[model samples]
Target: MSESAGQPASVALFGTSADPPTLGHRSLLEGLSRRYPLVRTWASDNPFKSHGAPLAMRAALLEAVVEGLESPNLRVDQSLSSPRALDTLERAARQWPEAELVFVVGSDLLPQIQRWYATDEILRRCRLAVVPRLGWPLDSLQIEQLNRRGGRVEVLPLQIPATASSAIRRHPDPQLVPPELWPVLLEQNLYGLRSCLASRPPLR
Candidate 1:
């Protein structure tokens, strides 16, 4: 993902389950914003997994996290959310016609990319950028497999915390997510989070 003269600005397209956006999400967005001219993210549903929360609620939470970041380069665009990566790419193509789009994903999801719908076509349209998770290592074999399938991938040099939404769902830790979302988590009783914050004073 190098820039050349007269080349359009590169934009990162990041979509996540964001069941409740966490500190890890904030770190990823901040890292991406520093590297790309524009970073667009949204809360989405994974076709292969069951969601604990509704899409609208998840999107709202992600939007709130993005707002807290206050990065001029970062944005939460719910319109770009889609279960299929191909559809999301198409939406981004239409929205940022002049910019080069880099479809972002985590290393933990590398194995599943090969199984996505129109995998080759999605790879063809955008540069695939994989951010290495703390526990998930970038596998050369997987990268080779994707390359063989007409995919162009770049492993981003960004280190985010080893936080996961799944862990928060199971344990309901207030420390895992941003403070701005504490009230929502309690009010909505999401992820059994009420008990976790019961001892603390209410958030305004």
Candidate 2:
């Protein structure tokens, strides 16, 4: 683990599968980088989901995206060993003992966070910074439940482009991805819109 020189007192780690990171992912990181002293984006190797591409391939795709941005604060972690959410958080905490670890995630994942392995311990280590997702209702019941369980979650209302990786993967037009990122997508060999649309069912 490498640390950025002259980093702020508070650093955040954004971890995800990032099979093929979308514009929303980029927006969240870019936003957080401005607020925090240091921000590192990590792509985990998940054993649960069937990935569209291999771990190395996905990491390379993320690297391409980061390279295009030319942001020194942004980084891609390519850890081969797939650890659970808690384990990854613990490692980050140890790596940056001086900086407070803020875990960045989407609101859609909040409902299921309790089911994550050692979730209580995970919360103890880092505060969660949630970005709102389209179609996911962050209601009172959910908020109460999260608070009742000692969750240190902070909700941020960010109006991100309503484009999910799954939606792009299943859509008829590959142009669903922003025109600026078309070259990256093509270089990464992500299924074009027509190919993806023909290959999978419509987004629900």
Query: TM-score of every model?
Result: 0.92, 0.81
- Count backbone overlaps in model 1: 0
Give the C-alpha miss distance for residue 190 in model 1, angstroms. 1.6
Model 2: per-residue Cα lDDT over 1-204, one tens digit each: 235644357777777666667777777767776777777776677666677767676666666666666678777765522458777776776667667788877878877778888877877787888888888767657656766778777887667777677765565355344344555555655756435545666433
lDDT of each: 0.88, 0.68
Kindly provide the TM-score of model 2 when superposed on the true structure, using C-alpha atoms: 0.81
* Model 2 spans with C-alpha error above 4 angstroms: 1-7, 80-83, 178-184, 193-204
Q: Which candidate is the best by TM-score?
A: 1
State which candidate has the highest lDDT: 1
